[model samples]
Target chain A: MDLKQSARDLAIEYLLQEIKKGNLKAGDKLLNERKLSENLGISRVPLREAICTLSTLGILEAHQGDGTYVSDSYSEIFSNIIKKYGIFDRSMVDEVFEARSLFEADAARLAARNHTEDDLVKLEQALKKHENALTDYYEEKLKDKDMMELDTEIHLGIAASSHNNFILEIVKSIRYVTLQQDYFSEQYTLDHEHFKRSSIMHREIFNAIKEKNEDLAYKKMQEHINEIRLALDIESIRRDIK
Target chain B: MDLKQSARDLAIEYLLQEIKKGNLKAGDKLLNERKLSENLGISRVPLREAICTLSTLGILEAHQGDGTYVSDSYSEIFSNIIKKYGIFDRSMVDEVFEARSLFEADAARLAARNHTEDDLVKLEQALKKHENALTDYYEEKLKDKDMMELDTEIHLGIAASSHNNFILEIVKSIRYVTLQQDYFSEQYTLDHEHFKRSSIMHREIFNAIKEKNEDLAYKKMQEHINEIRLALDIESIRRDIK
Candidate 1:
């Protein structure tokens, strides 16, 4: 490895070690450029590059004049990476949906286990929108776009309610990537069945949550995805790619 | 809902429209900071933040002096996000094996269908490394630590030799996330069974490639990952996670 690689590796190694050791607390600021460069025994370039890279990872937060601090916002960093990388081709959409099926199933199960009053209110609100949208074709398109976001809101709400940051963050990251993919946001008009099935799924999922039935919630979530799978043949996605 | 989110939502909506409408092309330079800020009627602070956020998503690439450009490096950006999201968790070790098994099985099948002398040589070199690692545990640690990089070399070699960037890059991203995860580097004695089965798997995969037995090659790849599932356990991971 040349000087640049060596410098970068050293810096990365040092920082990772510090993170692992808990010397770098979530909100602790790092040493400034002058000291950091001297300590790494390298010039400023590679050190800055590594810092920028870590900052991008949400491990560091650079606040202009305020220096770089270890960050608490893992999700923001995660979304940043997803926005950049998770753009997919048509066939990859099938794989993405497969992942989503598994992810949302778990999210629903967890949400069911921990639905607070606030969570119930949000869920009900999303469901009400679906019902209104189903009443008219023109209104449906206007609401269909927001439907996915609301759907995401419920799933995210469940993950948030699960009180597991690790799983919640994972679920959120997966959804973010899935939504950014070719398949998830593909232009579509909702048929009566599409709207009816969606409303039913949410209601069933909500009932499961209200009953605090994890298994029932998970199953319904899977069923919800299976419904989409039946309508949108995975193989048909390959045709779109070509 | 506030200024920051308003800016973010508008930026994403505008960019998505541009992407869909062909108003923005890959590698197109984004409007300069002043112009974009002016157009959006947002302060330089939020506009810069939005552009930086988009750049982090891999949609835009801000070259220091050259202005921000739409990225040609989406694959890397995507891979970085996947890695950052902990998509390579202990759970994914199993999933990676499943995905790799499916992917490499296809890759081997493809290689068998179209193996040149060079492809065969590289495959042999990969097998040799597997063999050498079993005998030389220290080197294996380094190789295994960054196994995705090595795996990428062999897998991409197969995909590239078959001349499919789309298949190559997607599989390449999904395959490497586990190897790039911090969990991979945590101290663990190499499982002898893992090394043994891996050796057997590679030999069979290579033979299928050499003989052009697509079915056999693919099956061997699947068998390889199936064995890997039994060979590694990562509950030790929970201890290392912060």
Candidate 2:
């Protein structure tokens, strides 16, 4: 390994531990390059790289004359690190699923309550794409990947229509973080019945939104997320992990 | 400015424009170091630095034996940049308000439907502290600061009691992102009148939770977030920015 790379990793590890211990906070400018070098026993070159890395992850900030500061709090830092560990890690998946359930449920409720005509059009367009992907049903090659992508599109559409950028951003991030695991797999191909059920559920959610019934929307959204949970066989996975 | 940093800013600015124009995407790796230097008319050092910065942002990822690939989609990149900007510019307050409105409303609904006796005690404790802060009605001199903090504390308390870590984490992160607005100036001094009213609202929310009336609890939480909306005045600020 390169010296600078090792040094950069060290800086991240040390800073992560400190933040985890609550030794740092937002706006607390970080140590200067020279001082950080001295403190970490690494050269300024690698320390700067590490600081810059964390800065990108939103855990640290760089000021022209001042210094780097720990920016994000522990939980935020944990979220980023959790991404690095990948989604198949049962705990992370559980966390993501749990988070998604909360978000999607709320999103559905909001969309149902406040969806405008425009929101409805966008949602219908997304549903059309999902339906189009189903045309390849007999051809197993495209079934799995297409379904996942379609599912993401539908969810993203719902989040977008809810008019909440923050939730959309987080949900988008969640999708990115879990891309390798869920976006493409043979499951959609193998579980044809599940795909049919999911299609019906999507249609039901759309109808609920169209009817502007927040309760039905929330319930359907919850059921949809729970369906994914069950399809992933997460309950068994969670038990196995424990 | 350092040469590499100057190079990085230029690269970032360049790449951001490309992303905005929809010219880049995931899995699209850039040219080799030598080729990129030739193309951009810069030395390898600056090019490498720029790529590293983008890489750190998770927009690009460098493969040891391969090239640099855009690790994120354009929307993901934009979201990160926007989120960071919100924090640095203090617009995160609005972001927090939007998210909290949704989360709190949902949490209230859930808590009312799901709260146990233990949950009641915890909610009661938070309410008590809120009342205590009111009695100590020394005007909190800082305006922007301390606004969402206890709000977050109360939120976390409710989320924790609601027994939903997903809600807890998102709410936690929303607070985390906004806290990036370094506590610069405190906004309003505690007007005894205002504090008294706020205390009453807290009590109202408490009573709703105690009563386990999901609709009432949700309505109360919605009103609470609106009150905070006025306190933060996020929507107007966003309008002003645009």
Candidate 3:
């Protein structure tokens, strides 16, 4: 590597080391540039570049006149990353769904094993909200945004029930990207039939988790995603024919 | 949200819109601060804040004195995000492995369907290198880093064979995080038996891919990961007992 690249790498390594050692943490404001550069034995130029790199990675937040801070939420970082990448093409969308299937299936399995009473209550509440949203939509009383938010809530509730922070964050990221795309895409639509089928599938998944049936939960979650994938594929084909 | 947050959001939305319209491309140098701010009808402070946010998210790169540019690669952004998050605990490790299982299985399935002659050649070359590295290690002639690199190369080759750039990139990101953690962790080690089993599993996966047996390839890939997970679990248990 050239001198510039090496310097940036050194800076990255130093910062990561600090984070790993707990010298830096999420939501912690970084020290002033001059002090940090001096402490790391690097000049201000490379130090700034490194900080800029970290910021671009969504690991740090820079507020004007407020200094830089480590990001407290991985979900925000993930949503930003997805938006930046613009993963909306058909193939990319398919890949995202594939990822979601895996993540949610594993999440369902874990939730079956790990959920507490509070989690069960939250899951039921989310499910009820989703069911009510679907009912309102079918009755022509709900907006798309409301249904979308409710749909996201139900999936996120199951993810949270897994009791694994990492899984929760990953699921949130995937859901954010998928929902953002759906919200913005003109081709995305939810008819009564799709909503009806989706509601039943959601209930089955919820029940499987509630019963603590890990295998059944995993299978149901996978089937739920596969159905969605099939619906998306059909829509794409219809668009193509149109 | 506060005024500052709203301004930042506006800036982010504006930039993302520009990107989606192909007005901005990867590696394209961003316009000067004054010009961009003026064009957006926003002041320099908010525009700069927006740029800083993009920079932190790895969507843009800032050279020392040169103008900022869109990142050429998303993998760099992903690596930075992973490092910043520092997902190293047991549950996080399991989550990462779950992600890998999903990603690699999908990649393997796609590779089975999509591999061209050239891809097969590359895959064979990577597998051969891995096999050689394992042999050398068992003969006490190789270092851990060498074997690790070879192992990564084999998986990356399979990902590349999938013929999907998005899948390839996601797999690369997952592997980078997992390998980085393994490289730095004192708990990570590979014994001869583990290498032997891994070699067998890799060949099985390769053969399944070569034969265009998608189901078999997926199954083998999942099995390969499960074996690794089992080995890690066993090691953790042993550590706990000791």
Candidate 4:
């Protein structure tokens, strides 16, 4: 490795050690550059490079004219990475859906097991919003973008209900990536019948979670995602035939 | 959002769009800063920041005296983020194991469905290595580090056999995080009996894959991971009681 790269890696490793040791924490201001560089026995240049790299990774935040601080969430860093490198070919769409299905199914199972009353209420509201969007779409009063947002909101609510912050963050990041790709590629056509079916699937998943049926929740979520994958695959085939 | 942050986001989004359009590819050198910045309607400063961000994320590589190019694998980026932020409390260890179990079980299923003769050969070799390590441990000749490496290699081989790049990347990242945490905490004592059990589980999983039994592979892998989780939980409780 290059000297600068090695230095950056050392600095990052040290920072992670500090965080693990509870010497540094989320939202805590880091030591000043001079002090930190001196303490790490590295030059200011490599230390700054490491800081910048961490800031870019969303583990650290640098405020203008203010000291840097550890970030409270690594979700944004994850999202940033997803946005940058998650461009997939048409063939990879199924892989994306497969991965999403795995995540959502597991998230649903966890949500069924762990959801609080508050989480149930949130899921109910999200389901209502999704139902309303589906109704509007059926009436020709909602655009695809509105429907997509509502769909994402409902899934995000389920993921949040899982009560596992790590899984929640990852599901959210994957959702963002898939949504961005769909938006950019105009991948899915608005099918009224498919929308109706998806609404029903959403309700089934919600009810399963509310009833605390972990297996049912997992099955419903998995079936819902698999349906979407099938639809996309058919759409791609149709486009190719065109 | 901060102006600079927004600018970087914009540049990153535009670059992603370009990649989706096939204007850039893995190992493709980015356009010169002057031309690219002007084309993207951004100043060079923010553009450079975005480039630096991508480089840090392992999506791009900045070669000394050479222009930057897209990276072939995004696995490094995922591993980097996991390494930086996967510090969890003892309670969260089960959650981590749950997530890993989900990933690894699915990977095992896929491996059973997709593994070629070559893939099976690799997996068998990995299993053999793991079995050797287990024997060494039984004889008090193997270190924790050696055991961990062997364990990771076995899992990585299974993931590779899955033939899904995305799942492989995720499994690799999760393994890196868990191994790092285990190393740092000395969380798992060297239990000869546990090692023997694990070696048996590994063999069962390998046989399932070799037999092309997807469901069996999934079940065995899931059981193996849950066993590990149970052991860790017990270990943590014992430590608490101490």
**What DockQ, between 0 and 1, does each candidate earn?**
0.06, 0.12, 0.17, 0.28
- Which runs in model 1 stand beyond 4 Å of their true positions? A1-142, A157-187, A190-192, A202-223, A229-242, B1-186, B199-237
Better of 3 and 4 by TM-score: 4
Please, what are the lDDT tens digits per residue for candidate 1 over residues A92-177? Answer: 55545554565567667767765688878877776776666666634445544466666676667766665444446556766665
Lowest summed lDDT over 10 consecutive residues: which window, candidate 2 chain B? B183-192
Model 1, global lDDT? 0.62
**Every model: iRMSD:** 8.2, 10.4, 5.1, 4.0
Question: How far in Å is the alpha carbon of B50 misplaced in model 3?
Answer: 8.8
RMSD of each: 10.7, 15.3, 6.9, 6.8
Candidate 2 lDDT over A101-201, as tens digits, reads: 76788778777866789989988988887777776764665656667788888887887666666666666666655554442255322345577678889
Ranked by lDDT, top first: 4, 3, 2, 1
Q: Please give, for residues A41-122, the per-residue lDDT of candidate 4 as tens digits.
A: 8888678767876876778899778989998865566666755565432245556676788878989998998899998888
Residue B189, model 1: Cα distance from true site in angstroms: 1.9
Candidate 4 DockQ vs. native: 0.28
TM-score of chain A of 2: 0.60
Per-prediction fnat: 0.03, 0.23, 0.09, 0.32
Residue A209's C-alpha lDDT in candidate 2? 91
* Residue B240 shift from truth in candidate 4, angstroms: 9.7
lDDT of 4 at B213: 97
DockQ of 2: 0.12
Error (Å) of candidate 3 at residue A68 is 10
What is candidate 3's CAPRI-style docking category based on DockQ? Answer: incorrect
Q: Which prediction has the highest lDDT against the true structure?
A: 4
